[model samples]
Target: MWDMNFRRISGLLRRVDRLDHIDRLDAASHSAHEGGEGFSARHHRGVFELLPGTGLTLPRHAGVLRFGMSEREAQWAVATLADVRGTWVCRAGWAFTACYEGLELLAYGDCVDLGVSGFTAVHLHRRGPRLTEPSAVPVVLQDIDLFGYPANEVLAAVEPNLHPTVRLTPPPSPADHLSAVSLSAG
Candidate 1:
């Protein structure tokens, strides 16, 4: 599983680099918006590319609060994610980001492609039903800050994801069991 997912992520890294070099993302949105590694068949549904120097933009999501963070906010968010279980730690265009993989699966496996650079984070969400309609809605975040962002912004982005922080605890390993047995024998 690890190797497979790693390969998948590695492929995504290369594709992201390819997309980054292009001049007009708008012109190349669909073509450059590469699908992910078998997460879904419709990976090219909608694409929102985040560029450098764009401070922060919150995509217009109906129920999901998808947005990038300031440096301080990003570091803090990392801490939050690090504590969570089943999170997808991503290397986006030379920066870092994480996703709640379990929650996504629970939510019918919605794909949220997030990219982070030294000073920016870009995201795209798939906003259509596979059986219902085959259309894509691209989301573009706005420039804002944690301090200036609307209330519940952080909450919305971080709340549904919080449950994972408790679910990723691994059970004791065989080595640990052996140590306990040896202690009892001694």
Candidate 2:
């Protein structure tokens, strides 16, 4: 069992190093700028300034992508803003992730654990990229800068009462900072 767990973790670790796929991401970014087929021009140049209660709801949408939408719809929603990293299966469900400069968007589908289908959940991460730099896209939640502001400050600003429905997972350690600002499909 330990060996299996180790292997699974190893595979996950390998996937985390996406620097080698820079060309693919670059191509996607270029096409988005050129307004290539199926890619629409993003508003505010793809900087996602999210409103917590409106867009970042646990039972609803994450930005423009809504819960219960198909994987293709989710892809289309973020096509101009990110590079889709393809799909993978895990214990919780099947998921596809997309990458941005400093953010990562993960959408889940066909979740056996939850006995649900379609895109059930979407997560937005501030620490998604393994690179050393901060996110290129500015992600703001309720006027608080998710990437630019200090983690503790951001946390304090988005206290639980602010949006009782949204799930805010703080970093394990203070040094680690804010890793993700995510909401589940309630």
Candidate 3:
């Protein structure tokens, strides 16, 4: 299952890079009016690319599932891609909401393409007039792997709807059986 999912992620990342290239071209040709808001009104859209394993963290057992870019990147993407003058907020699953244009676009994740090395690409965008000083959205990036049965089951009782964090029993091995017999006879 892991292998299959890994492959799928890999393929998706390639497609993302290609699409970003196309988006860059589109931004260059676009001529959109900047809305009179604090947000920058540029014709270019920014593409945030995630490298595989980049979001992984150990103590929490959850990786950096999402990222809210630096102020510079955010402004760049919004101006280039979004036509209206508005502030863009990246919501869950890479979805962005532009307050001015009222536009929502879903950005997909591509960690698998990054492979073990992980991904690194410029989130393309065009410079636009600043509506207000660009500010980054405060995002509570959660670890996707730390949720569900594997993490929760071990911490609590197994329920029909809830998965356990730990495996209920370890698989039997020769050493385990031998120890059991020795203890029983003793």
Among all candidates shown, the one with the greatest TM-score: 2
Q: Please report, in order, the local distance difference test score of every candidate based on alpha carbons.
A: 0.26, 0.54, 0.25
lDDT of 2 by residue, 57-141 (tens): 2211234665667777777676655667777767545677877665677767767677766666667787543323235554556
Which pairs of residues have clashing backbones in candidate 1?
A: 56-142, 57-141, 57-142, 58-141, 58-142, 84-165
Better of 1 and 2 by TM-score: 2
Query: Which pairs of residues clash in candidate 2, taking residues 3 or more apart in a chain or in different chains?
Result: 102-135
- Using TM-score as the measure, what is the rank order of every candidate, best first? 2, 1, 3
User: RMSD in angstroms, all models?
Assistant: 19.7, 13.6, 21.4
Candidate 1 global TM-score:
0.20
**TM per prediction:** 0.20, 0.57, 0.18
Clashes of each: 6, 1, 18
Model 1, position 80, has a per-residue lDDT of 39
Model 1: per-residue Cα lDDT over 1-186, one tens digit each: 643464365441223233223324434554456542232212322222222233222222212212333334444433332331233334332333333221111111112343222333322222222312111222222211111112233224423643321111111331110000000000
Candidate 2, residue 161: the lDDT equals 50
